[model samples]
Target: MAYEGKGVWCVGEVRHGDLSPSLFELITAGRIIADARSETLTAVLIGKGVAAKADEVAARGADKILVLEHDALDQLVDEAHTGALTAAAGTEKPRTLLFSASVYGRSVAPRVAVALGGAVASDASALTVTDGKLTLERSAFGSAVISTVAVNAADGPEVVTTAPMAFERSGTSETKAEVTQAAVDPASWTQNTEFVSFSADESKEIDLGGAEKIVSGGRGLGNADNFSLIRDLAKSLGAAVGASRAVVDSGWIPYKHQVGLTGRQVRPRLYVACGISGQIQHLAGMKSSDVIVAINTDADCPMMKLATYSVKGDLTQIIPAIVSEIDKVRGSSNGS
Candidate 1:
């Protein structure tokens, strides 16, 4: 395997005012691949005056910073951003393209790959490079087994979208590298959608990823009212609250808090499931958790079978008792 002159490019993510956290996370992970291949890790920051953010990326171990500065790129319109990224990728000719599996990255990676005549693996849990080939591991069959795939592409870069929580952030020394600025014309872009407004909830929400403790409730929570107990327990433990697909579909909780095959995939340190049946689909989303605790009435439930700890009882009574215990612990911590 004659492997030389390989470049790894990570798509820079930006929100309204500053760089996104996930972009840093990706850079941290991309550095590993870059070091493994003995190649440079470049970051593409696309937006007007985005070049100024190169210093921040440099702090995160980017060897080269490619800034696509354009007035039209100021706003993250999928079409414009994708076009600019595709154009930049064409010019750079990286061997591998890494992107965060975020809202923006999900929208852009596939389109850019298509434009570059490359192959894309989305939402991959693991990525490895060997012998000049990239192998992507992704969950399949309701998250029971992962299918490892080697993307075969004859031209352009191989695109890979990594789950936000798939890999821990790389701890590498920063490298001061050259910054290249490319301004793409928006008129040349094929715009199918227009930006209407960017008004969204500005409040910071708890990120399920990287959460040290998580408390999730399933359909067995009984009613929407019973979720309060779960919430109480989560608040006491300073943990994020999650719900199974059934509970979300039943409108017991918002879809954002759902954890299942079709919902947000989580890899928390401690996952506490109350009343969740532990279906394979549900299991797929959380099986990677470091520790699992199930509180269900049925002893034979699939989740209880795989749990590190199980408590069989009525959740209506059990959840409240757990919440009380957590509250007591918090009170002691606060000198109450």
Candidate 2:
């Protein structure tokens, strides 16, 4: 195939040897943008065994999968991957480039854009492509405001890394697509990093990144010991544990478990806030959830006002009761 301007190019990612679902989700959203601009959606699949990965890329409605396979490209050496992807961008010259706002993508996408002398919009919640220009929306300034950015670089394609939980996959396997293989090389690079074995926290092995249900607590939980109620409720509901700014600041919870402007953003199917007063900064991260349930003794709190389901009661009394009810239900079901 000739080097031509296509619709959009997404640098596909694989975590722990599996393709990230966020890639497919972006492709689903990209298709609509590309169609609106009358173009085809192409994807760059980089890593070992690129050919084997092409089938799934095609299945996900990618019009073209540019496969770059080489041992040097096995693990992301930032330098090599950036060079290879920048070369692919030159060859494909896509109108737009999409990437996940994942740690890996966030690290590399900006580098690639810089190498190409292109502008980038990082952590976008929504994207629109029209007349070869892209508009991206993202939360900004401690989530107190939303900013819409437009990128029209004279040098290269518009690059975008989407925020977590902004879009979902839409296309089926029937979408027409074709796959092609390509090779890219780096000019020069130095590899000095040594691989080291590190273990995950057994307690937090279940990541909250893509959780479907989330329950959070705030300073209203009273003290560090009282935070256990939040964890118990989350476990009973098979949900992830989160904390508000006040809770995190009070050292009741770690910063990683925090959900707010400076912390993680979650758009779960169900969000339950216990003892949290919905500050604007805190609400920015989770207000987009499909269902919001707030439990607070203060019935007039901001969170209670915004909650789809509000329960005016003491969390100390409510949480144990909920746990007991769940235990009883499970016990009865198991004939215990």
Candidate 3:
């Protein structure tokens, strides 16, 4: 298969006036495909005031950097991002475009693909280039199986949105990259969407993706009110709250708190599962945690088997006790 055009592009995301941590993971993924095809790797930073961060991306070994800046990009407007990316891709003509399967990426990848007459695959897990053919792997049926798909470069470029944490960020050498600023005029960019007031969940001020510790709940919690036990335990340990898909689907919590194959992939230092049966789908997301504690009545559940410490009992009874013990330790330290 003759690869079309040249270079592999990673569409990076920015947050809080700097680059997002997920950009490093995309770099790791892009590098693999770039090395396999013996092509140069470029990182595209598109946002307001993201020029300063291009140097850091270049330092991380990107061969080139394209910074598309516009005032309209101050917030994540799908049309504005889609237009900026489409213009950038039109000029650079990268064969493969990679994006993190995040809120921003999910909205932009397909739109860019449509504008460029390319193929797109979302929620992609693994990537491999075989004989210059780019192949992306997507999990099927709750991650119980994986499907491999090859994109035909002859038709157009391949635009891919990868699952967060699906690719690990490894160490990279400091290398310089040629940075180019593409000022996409606002007039050219489309904007049918209006900016609304942004309301954040105060309870989730601690980001689940970056949280060191997480306490997750499942349907076994019995009712939505029981989720407070999970929240209390998480608060006691100064950890973020997570939930299984079953509970999130049941409206016990928001989708942002879901940790599973089809949800957020997290690698916390400590992961405590309460009243969770630990399906394979749930394990697929947090199995990489350094420590796993499973609390369930049935000790033979998959989560219990995978946990570093398994407690066979009722989580309603167990969670409060753990929280109480932590409180006692904290109190003793405070008194000391």
Candidate 1 lDDT (Cα, 0 to 1):
0.81
Of 2 and 3, the candidate ranking higher by lDDT: 3
Model 2 earns a TM-score of 0.84
Give the higher-lDDT candidate: 1 or 3.
3
Candidate 3 runs further than 4 Å off = 1-3, 16-18, 209-213, 219-239, 245-255, 260-270, 279-292, 306-309, 314-336
Model 2 misplaced regions, further than 4 Å: 1-4, 48-56, 175-177, 184-201, 323-336
Winner by lDDT? 3
Candidate 1, residues 136-250, lDDT tens digits: the string is 8887787767899998767656788887767766455655768888758677669988877877655354667547688999889888998988888788778888999998988
Each candidate: how many clashes? 0, 0, 0
Candidate 3 lDDT, tens digit per residue, 1-336? 443568888888886485777777788899889999899998889888899887677777678889998778877889988988888777878998999888888888988888888888887768888898888888766555688988775666898988766677645666688999886977876679987867756663467875779999998899999999998998898899999999999999999999988888787889999988988889888887889999999988899898999999987888889989999999999999
Residues 1-336 of candidate 2: C-alpha lDDT, one tens digit per residue: 322355788778865366767777678667767888888788778877666777777767777777877677777667777777887777667767888887777878898888777778888878776675678788777666789898767766677888766777645677656777776664444445433444556685345666779989987788899999998999998999999989898999788889987788887889999999899889988888989999999999999999999999989999899899999999999995
What do the candidate models score in CA lDDT, each in turn? Answer: 0.81, 0.79, 0.84
Name the weakest run of 10 consecutive residues (lDDT summed) in model 1: 1-10
lDDT of 2 at 12: 81
